[model samples]
Target: MNHSPDTGTFQVIHAYTRAEAIGDGVLVDVTDTAREAGYLLPVAMTSAAWAEAVAWDETNRALQDEAGRLWDVLWMARPAAARTGFGQTRIAFDVLRVPNHPAATEPHRVTLHVHIGPGDDGHAVLTVLLAHED
Candidate 1:
């Protein structure tokens, strides 16, 4: 429940929190590894983003690993975040990802969008999702 000056007090019917999302696997927590990449704030990736951009398997294992792919995503995000206005709420970045598709022969570029918004407790959190996701 919350109060507002313009509107009367109202109760939140329901809410889905960042923690819940992570627990449910809708979001994948990458805060620890993100810290290794220099991110100080909480970081998560949408499940779709994970499946499409970061998930790696034995099909591509001979050439890559999950850690390396995750690192690449963060490494690319850094400069995109830096070049954007500090006050901006959303940042867009691209990564040249090697397809996990067994028959693919080259890396393909994909755009990932980073959204900075209030989490369940109101602390700002970052979410990396596909460009088409919210």
Candidate 2:
């Protein structure tokens, strides 16, 4: 089956993280922030085959594979504040997928934007953007 690039769409799954206050009582310790962040963000891909897989709840498998391969690159690319928890941290993101004339090998691209500090409830908010390419 042939899928049109313009038919693709992006979706945001959820946002989550594991964080602990630092010893200095000034920051928090977030281990494996990238992995955690990745999990929080939804998966995106440009493949009719992959999209079909996702419809059947098989997207996790694809995400696992991609994450395994790109974890290092994504993790290292994370912002400094995200690496070291200072105050309450929040990563807010919006996932978008747009069809192109010819789909690229990596159809899905995750654009992540983070926010640090406590919310009104005095809790950390991690914002994530999940985009899937059609």
Candidate 3:
């Protein structure tokens, strides 16, 4: 796993893999202006074969795998802020905390949005967005 900041949002780039039949993953420790908002280990992968193993309910395992992974993002994300479209899906998770900074007036609410889609070669593409609510 490798990550960089995209604008104000923290972005993570990952390649999915299986070791001994278990999925490899990441744990993100997000922070607000005041303090830590806790952590999330988002599940992701690149191949349809891996998706098939994880998406047990899909008959069309390839397509189902994409949706299933998107669902995983949705599980941790805020429902009112989520969006799904042609070839792509986006979801946000809110981190809760009260800001104690001297210059701060509002509680810091960190929102994490996960964007997912299919690459040109049909592999999965995932992008993560982290932002604070003013």
Best by TM-score: 1
Q: Global lDDT of each model?
A: 0.85, 0.35, 0.37
Ranking by TM-score: 1, 3, 2
Q: Better model by TM-score, 1 or 2?
A: 1
Off by more than 4 A, model 1: 1-7, 83-87
lDDT (tens digit, per residue) of candidate 2 on 27-47: 232335444755333222223
Residue 58, candidate 2: Cα error in Å is: 7.4
Query: What lDDT tens digits, residue by residue, belong to model 1 across residues 29-120?
Result: 99999999998778899999998888987765448878989999988887765654477878899999888877765889999988888888
In model 3, what lDDT does residue 80 have?
Answer: 27
| Model 2 poorest ten-residue lDDT run | 49-58
What tens-digit string does per-residue lDDT give for candidate 3 at 1-111?
344455555555755532321332332212121022122222332233222222233343223343443344344543423354554476556543233223433434545
Q: For model 2, what is the C-alpha lDDT against the true structure?
A: 0.35
Best by lDDT: 1
Q: How accurate is candidate 1 locally (lDDT)?
A: 0.85
